[model samples]
Target: MSDDDLAATLATEAGRLLLDVRREFADASVDDRKAAGDQRSHDFLMAALAAERPDDAVLSEEGADDPVRLSSRRVWIVDPLDGTREFSEPGRDDWAVHVALWQDGELVAGAVALPAQGVTLATPTVATPPAAPQHPRIVVSRTRPPDIAM
Candidate 1:
């Protein structure tokens, strides 16, 4: 319904990724063969929808990106698992959970759901708030990529 709602749902879903189960997938590492069909993130978000908004329909990246729901006034766009590659790595920040809502073909709200970081931040409906640069200059992504030290 709202960005806050989506954020809560995504956060809950991503939190489940830290669970222990009989899961093995090939897509993670090059050596493995099969992409494990474990539905950790999928199950969590699906469950969230069931518990939160049972009446609404959903189109998820890791589950089902339904073309039929494109025309709907309010459709939930979810990426249950964004960076399966980085997520598989022992230490990588290339993964993220995305939750967004579209109203009349426009993105009304969005949320970046980070379960590993244990924080859910909502995307502003308008332009993002300007950053208060405490340092001398703005560092581009080309200069910083999380692993490097300042």
Candidate 2:
């Protein structure tokens, strides 16, 4: 599959896996849910990337920061689970899976899978978003906003 397609597919699959994990751990503690989600999703993503792109290096949030990725021409940067807190909380749809491919110092492909929302936004095949409101609102973290947002 093409890099763009691979990214989108992997991200979507990972998101599905996370949803399953969440359901299985619904009655467990918050920490347990978060840990399971992170490890399972990370493992799934790593295995899929290794099988699909054997020669490419991967840098995942849940995996070690391998120095080999720095020298590789193609690297897959992934976040198996982006919002651990929200993911562990029941009924929250803010969590997501992120997959991005960097080639020769440039981003070649990327995808964000929102499993709870049943949305997968991917590059090269993304649709134009609807027009914004007359007064656009800036959304930032409630507890800690970025410097730019400040």
Candidate 3:
């Protein structure tokens, strides 16, 4: 399939895996659950990309930073689980899975899946950004505050 299709599929599948992890570790400690979810989704996404696009480079939040990606023509940047804290919390739906394709210089494709919300936003399915809200709001991470906030 094309890069766009692959990105969306990977993000969606990874989100599903994370949801399963949450169910399987319902009684586990938050730290344990978070670790499991991160590793599981990271491994799934990495293996899928290797099998599907063996020639391209990958940069993952849970994987080693390979210098090879800097020289490659195409690179896949993924965050298997963008919000570990949110994922570990019961009933929280703000966490997401991110899969993006950086080709040449610009981003060619990308996807973000919010599993609990059952929403997957992909490049193929996205329309122009909605107009700015009359009352804009900033959402901050509960676990890691930005350096600027320090």
How would you encode candidate 1's per-residue C-alpha lDDT over 13-69 as one tens digit per residue? 564453221134423552231123125666777787657766556788767566667
In order of appearance, the predictions have TM-scores of: 0.61, 0.83, 0.83
Model 3 spans > 4 angstroms off = 125-150
Backbone clashes in model 3? 0
Q: By lDDT, highest first, what's the ranking? A: 2, 3, 1
Q: Please give the CA lDDT of all the candidate structures.
A: 0.60, 0.94, 0.93
Could you tally the backbone clashes for each prediction? 0, 0, 0
In model 3, the Cα lDDT at residue 110 comes to 95
Report the alpha-carbon TM-score of model 1 versus the true structure: 0.61
Q: Please report the candidate that would top lDDT against the real structure.
A: 2
User: Any idea what lDDT model 1 has?
Assistant: 0.60
